[model samples]
Target: MSGKMIDTRVTIDGTFGPFDCRLDPRLCYTKPWFPLAETRKVAARTQYLAYKHGNSSTETIHVIEGRTDGPDSVHLIEGVPGRNGTPAVAVRIRWKGARPTATLGEATADARREVTRKATARRKAARSGRTGAPRAVVVHIDWCGLGEDFDEAAFVVEPSADGLYPVGAPEWRWDFASWWCPACQDSQPWHEVTCPCGLSRPATPLGAAGWNAGCALHCLTPEATSVLVDLDGSARIVDVHAGDTRIDMDRHAEPFGQAEEILRTALAEAKPGELAATGWERAPGRLWGRRYQITFPASRP
Candidate 1:
């Protein structure tokens, strides 16, 4: 299918003593089906799978009371009632683009928290005068958030402070800290560190950079994206604003050549705070030889 194909749906409903719903062999090595591992288990057992995909989309799927043997098809085997005690379950598979399902969303959120925890732990470990080297934290830069206004941000994963990482929205505020409840085997923010079962856990310091970068990214305007790059093998974003020329966030996805020219011109001639835009404009050449232009769009429009 072409890239324009945004949404597709598939339904699988059947029962058998034992059968295999084989899939593309290439995907075995690729992680295209990841993040949905848990959801696939639920969907497979419930005999229902609903997926949706788009630039920014949500998904809803049913989870039945069943568990998979492994993260892959190897775990889907089980015993059957009859047929010489052969496996009773059957596998059905389908592929879809990256659509956020409840399971996948939860996984992403958990990953985000783990990343924050690891980064924070590394920073804390460095400051605590610990003997061991800080945890190896590798930050990933991506354009996330919802809608066309998606901006660049970083994420990484590490162990939870109390060795417990829960699934849900992360608490990344400056004052948020993680506390573990032994009774529940889960973690919570400092405010609710006390479990309903009367188990109260002590708070652990969260790294300052976690909340600092989060808050900074959130406060940036939608029209302005945080430009992150991997230069010299290290991921970093240098926030250097041109005095007179502003980066056009709308055209952030344009070709590399166009973006390079804009950057070159802005650096060479743009005064502080100057605005720039990228679009098509007629050039002083053959009638059909118009070229792309960069200038401020009409303010009134």
Candidate 2:
């Protein structure tokens, strides 16, 4: 505030904008180059860094769209540009590492693939009349700790009554097979899947067993006892990430904790299931100790 105004330009995409990167002495003292306290102070300020910093340095115009997560996406831009005052810039921004999710394109693509795969499996199940919905793998959860390798240490996916029918075969494709849409939400084309919120449904094909491979996250279930969790749904689930991590095959992998959080949040916002859990107990381990049981929401005709 004491110094005379100095003109500086920050480039975004192809546009240049005003910026001030002059290291504030107060802020500079907290440089990582220094020790403990300094770094902590800097860290606190950095914890809320905006993408504008990157946009200023690298001259990249990154615009985020949508609500409920636009700002979060900008968190992807971290680190200073490798080259200063250069038309081009470089930064080892761990876009994925910055958050617990993939890019929009990545998430959508993965969802599309999952939906198709599930449709195929469902079609097969329907041929066999596998009326049996995905079973919930009951895991009594306990303490969760990140391994030294930072791998998932404790996790379990519990069946929930968020009642998000996975995207499935179009009604014309699956005969006599219909999914639940909230109480009376407008229905989509997919009969095997529907959204109670009337949001877009899962894109999984009808009768497909999309859960054959992934189980990345775990959701705590107080609904039913000794049940397996299904991965396909109309909402964001850790199961997709779980399967990506080979969680089901690797008993050592602990992803149940993340899955539980996902389910908890979803169920908390959703209507209570008609099938209430009856029993409760704990699992034997350093984690997954306290487990509960309740019934699942009924499926649509």
**Candidate 1 on 1-301: residue-level lDDT in tens?**
1122111111122121011112222321111111233233323432321112321121122222211211111112122223333221122211122211111111243454454454554455457654532121111112123122222221222223322111111221112223333233344543454566565442212211122222233223222222322222222333312223444433243333333432443233323433222221223445423232222111111
Task: Quote each prediction's TM-score.
Answer: 0.14, 0.16
What is the C-alpha lDDT profile of model 2 across 136-183, one tens digit per residue? 111111111221211222122221143111111111121121222322
The best candidate in terms of TM-score: 2
Weakest lDDT window of 10 consecutive positions for candidate 2: 205-214
- Name the weakest run of 10 consecutive residues (lDDT summed) in model 1: 66-75
